[model samples]
Target: KKLDAKVKLWHHNSQGLFDYSTKDFQEYTLKWRGDAFLTKSNNRIQNQPSLPKTPIAKLKANDLALYPGHLFASLCQDLWLVARSFTNGYRLAPGDIVRLGAQAFKVKQICTDKPTNKGFSLTDLLVFQEPSGETSQVHSLPCRVCLSESYSSQNPLISPCNCKGSMKYIHLKCLQQSIKSRVHSTDYSLAFMFKNLSCELCSKQYSSKFYLNGELKDLLEIKNLPQPYVVLESLSCKEQGLYIASFCTKSILSLGRSHQSEVLIKDPSVSRNHAKLVYKGQGIYLKDNKSKYGTTILVKRPISLKENPHLEFQSENSTIQFKASGLVNLLPSCLRQPVAKGPKSPSLPLFPVNKGICLSTDDLDFLVREAQGELLNTSLSFCQDSIQNFEA
Candidate 1:
């Protein structure tokens, strides 16, 4: 609280004590490795034909000799043209002209190796002249899609899609038409909503919405109809039958009393077209379709008289219910009686009895007559024996 003072800080050196000072060191000598005269001659030869010989600062000859090709390349301009040609796998021959920067250069000589002993050998090339406007590339490249070199209205080629080289460029109109056709033709499933306009080959989707005109945009709204299996059952029939259908497989099933319906109910209450089992994406929907008696589905079981306890019955119900033991006891005595064993009928001959031989109709008739005669004789003998025994 005693005498508080506010002070400002100084930003720069007030005395200017920080100052510049010059210093020097000895000029160290480097041992020369190659002939200086040859190096000078090579440098002079590399310069432009029209320019006078100009001496540059002396560089370490030994260092330059180690990489003679690199040193020679540093002296020239437009080296990229030759580098590009080499990258493209084009073999350069003498007299081959290369165009670069609005100028044309002819390959004058191809030196396979460097003749000097002081430097490393490189594929030396001597090219002639700079770029000249007199000669130019005249031929135009064609579009891969249309295969057209030029348009009447001079429509320029563009590559909006992910394609490379010759297959890249295409006219705007051609692209639009192609997209329109693809949208109309391709079938969309449940995944259609997430799908975008894409190249069939590359699967690269179209990102630019501006490319989609009104017609194409509207076409995008058309989605593939969902196809699902359905069960069509007739409620009226005592023996209920279910039909499986789908939009993809079977289109529709008409239900009614009429024979024309795919699922005939044979119920008087049902109309000719009582209901239609329509298959939509959501699920199998039951459309009434305006029938005489409206279609209804029982959601729950109804109450019976037994459950109500109000109505009394003494064997009045059509359906009979009994316990397992009581049901067996209630069965008729005739039905419960044991089966009797009777005299066996004469057995017929086995099929194809004699290996490969099969009995004909005449043979079968003869065999039947013989068996009947023998049975009749035996019955007559038995009756006579019974009569004699009874008389005795």
Candidate 2:
């Protein structure tokens, strides 16, 4: 009788726990490293003024946080609002306790071998376990996810398809919804962490902006700003407006792509015209309010694959059609083209010839010619956004 057959372990730190607790923490207030940053963020907090200075204990459990939904827990002080620069901020020591919604982890070890002027970054590998006495994260089968290495024959994948080169496999369901199969064999996953994500529609970046709720905690990455994560949901319309997430650097936090869905981090600063949009908790949001000439559709919450948005996203077999109505005449015959973020040509080598080797100019020129071919050896493909005239 294994008392904990269905144990769920989340390998996260204090920030994850704080984010998962947004609902109750909404009223809590936050302050940025600089007062101007505060003014900017407060303006973006959407539908709210300053964050209420409240206590965590008074909040309900449901408001704490959930991995799979937009409804999360937040807190006062807005620590994460400014916790940027993973190379600095927040020093963790052994036996330190950290919380992640419904679960708390302790620092077992800090690999402090690397030396930096910032006194060894806080980005240390943290180990945690279930206080229930069930299992530790290191030894658990479900919790362990490792990167692909040279002879990983024993690595089990969610599907027959193997992982992309140099990528480690993490449980899809750990932070975001898991894909039953990796259809195209992608190099990145929703489970992995990212630093920058641009809107596929407008090529605009999703930078740190207003948080849906007030909460903050020092994070490992980025000093003096929130340890933010970008969220993209398979949402249905209803929750309107651009679903904006606030964090410094506006880099992508995570990306999730399954059979019929894909989620990404956004900066929410793109133009609102003639573009396809996706947001957190929202599945696929399309807007025709731009009168077909230049339409702007915003995705607010999760929607179904059968819905209008996923039809374009989940064309497992083919491309989906875009149906424009009242504004069709205002749009172009073929305005809804996807972005062209095709396979980029390989970059040239940094040191064409070893700098210290004392090579002649002739040798350098030869190396340059060879590198040119590498740069030209790529093709055009869909990146994400494709802006143009449209059809009604």
Candidate 3:
């Protein structure tokens, strides 16, 4: 009967089980006639029927409550469970529940390899504690930039960089205003006075994006920018953040490591004039400038051979060239009488010729082998003809 009750309860509240909160659990468990303060124990009760253990037995009740609905659901599914088993008797595993008075608590192991609140910073530790749903004195703290404690949903205080104490929290608008003041914007480009998007004191790059109260928010906001602008992001570890450069249809923007280049890349591998972006008509095209380390485009879909007749790509140490020519008509043009010349001939039976295909060193070697075989056949034929004539 207990087993049946448990099965029925699980079936009814399967959806809610994923995003189960303390309030929800308390409310739902009120209807249950079975043991209210139950633990996910592997050892069966002496007389009671068997009950299936909760899949999310590893998560502490407090930590589970702090999780967002999606994260809670993922935890219930055990998506991040490692395959290794905990052999140490001292170490508590998933499904091990402890009873304290009327309430039961589950044990969860959290990695403490990263130190908290050291000489470096306390922002991360404070941020972690902020989601506890408790009213804390931290809310009274003023913004470092504006020196105002007032904050609303429209313009909230955020700890974006690695700064501790009074220098930690700052209003989003104040930070944006500070960034805007340093930014040098012209008709063609927008350049930052600072090398990267980082805090002056901490020397840490500000997070590009962060979530607050389950809502996604951007750290930096650039407003009222010119149209037909291109934003380039550096993949290099040394340089970071988005660099914006605008261009007219007639003008070309040069990209390289040099200071003179319009879009500057501060990497050693990049040449002085690595590449150029040309805006023609409605389309933009990227062309290589014969750099030592050549430019590359990641091809996601099949490209039309007719539109792109010649294509060159670099693979490791070697450069590969692909060329496509007009289809070769195997039947002679004279053999087929010309029907009215419009643009294309339908009667020509066009076939792709090997000459138009991508040729490599292997293809040249195959041609050489064919020539040697033909010479050997010619020599054998000449010898047979001489023998026949001598016999005659």
Candidate 4:
């Protein structure tokens, strides 16, 4: 076979890794946030079943909305940030913190660009770096996806990207760090507007951050025709930049950071025995991990999670229900302890949990006040003491 000088075989996906041949090059798809993409002129719409519009009251900072892929896309953005690196090889999981440059930025989107014969590309990545480097051509999709997968260990000298092999490449996160402090340094648009729109299905509300984007605009907004059973959206922006990660009828992104966990829904009837949830960044996977079927998870509205840190997770049918907000943002980390490879970090006192522990909420509150500015987990010790004392 002849090769074009302009053609270069660059990236490969390791998903079906055991075969080694799984590295075949193909175009990855990255959709925009508000605009899901549609390639077929005959069919370009997204359809989701209705969800309850009622927002849950009194949700804790960590309480989450349970839904399929909802967690990985939103709450677990950080986790996806960590895991995204595995798109190459290294697998990541919850509770792992990636250390890199001294700054942080939001993951604006993940996308796969239009394909080329030489090889396919994933493009248009977003992040806010400190000092303030932000976006770069090298920082686009596939590159950023890989960089966000691993944690930053103090062991320097080795570059943060950690990628190796013949198809050697760059780290999008590193590229982001390199572009510090430029005016409007971010490649993502500074503006966002999600205040007024209802999910095409239940008309459920979602936050602005979790805005939907897909190519099937007509079918989604047709107002009368039977919408397609499945609608897909990618991470796109107002200017029409789409990232490669895919979202569908059962999937939606969650909105901010908090104590909630991302929710997942799976119907065996829809697919075969295989069902899994992946956070592209932090690399946490919650599927049939180590639990039996029918496990239940409860989450409140407006749940938030740090960009995906690995955490324990399980899901079932309607048993995994969440409010409208669940789909918009990844919820926060749990109030209770989480499993991690690192040393045990402290936990904060969950005022709501005090009652069961025999500690008064007010009393726990007072202790927390005293511990202000201390390590996050240190304050939790005070509450534990109060409980141990009361129980005695």
The whole-model C-alpha lDDT of candidate 3 against the native structure comes to 0.36
Off by over 4 Å in 2: 1-129, 132-225, 231-247, 250-313, 324-392
Pairwise lDDT winner, candidates 3 and 4: 3
Tell me model 4's lDDT, rounded to 2 decimals: 0.22
Winning candidate number (lDDT): 3
lDDT of 2 by residue, 1-392 (tens): 00000111122223222222122322322221110111112222211122233211111111111010111223322111111111121222223222111122232322222222232222222221112221111222332244322222122222111233322133323212221221122222222232222222333332222111233221123221122222222122322111122222322222211232222212122122222222222111222211111111111112111122112210011111122212223445375322212122122122211111111121334434433432343221111010011110
lDDT of each: 0.30, 0.21, 0.36, 0.22
Question: Tens digit of lDDT per residue, candidate 4, span 102-211?
Answer: 11112222222222222212211222111212111222223333443333322111222224442123342332333221111112111221212322223333221211
RMSD to the true structure for each prediction, in A, is 52.7, 27.4, 31.2, 26.4
**Clashing pairs counted in every model:** 2, 74, 0, 96
lDDT, candidate 3, 1-392, per-residue tens: 01111111112232112111122211111112121212222321111112223221111111111111122122221111110111110121112222111112222111211222222111221112122221112467899988999998667787766789999888878887987775545555554444455788887776555565566555445543344444443333443334455554224777677777776655565678766655443333345565544444321111222332333322122222223223334667676323221112111111111111111111323333433443453444433432344335
User: Pairing residues by index, what is the TM-score of model 3?
Assistant: 0.35
Q: In model 1, which residue pairs have backbone atoms overlapping below 3 Å?
A: 103-131, 103-132
lDDT of 2 at 60: 12
Off by over 4 Å in 4: 1-32, 35-289, 294-297, 301-306, 309-392
Q: Which stretches of candidate 1 lie over 4 Å from their true place?
A: 1-140, 151-156, 184-195, 211-392
Error of 3 at 161 (Å): 7.5
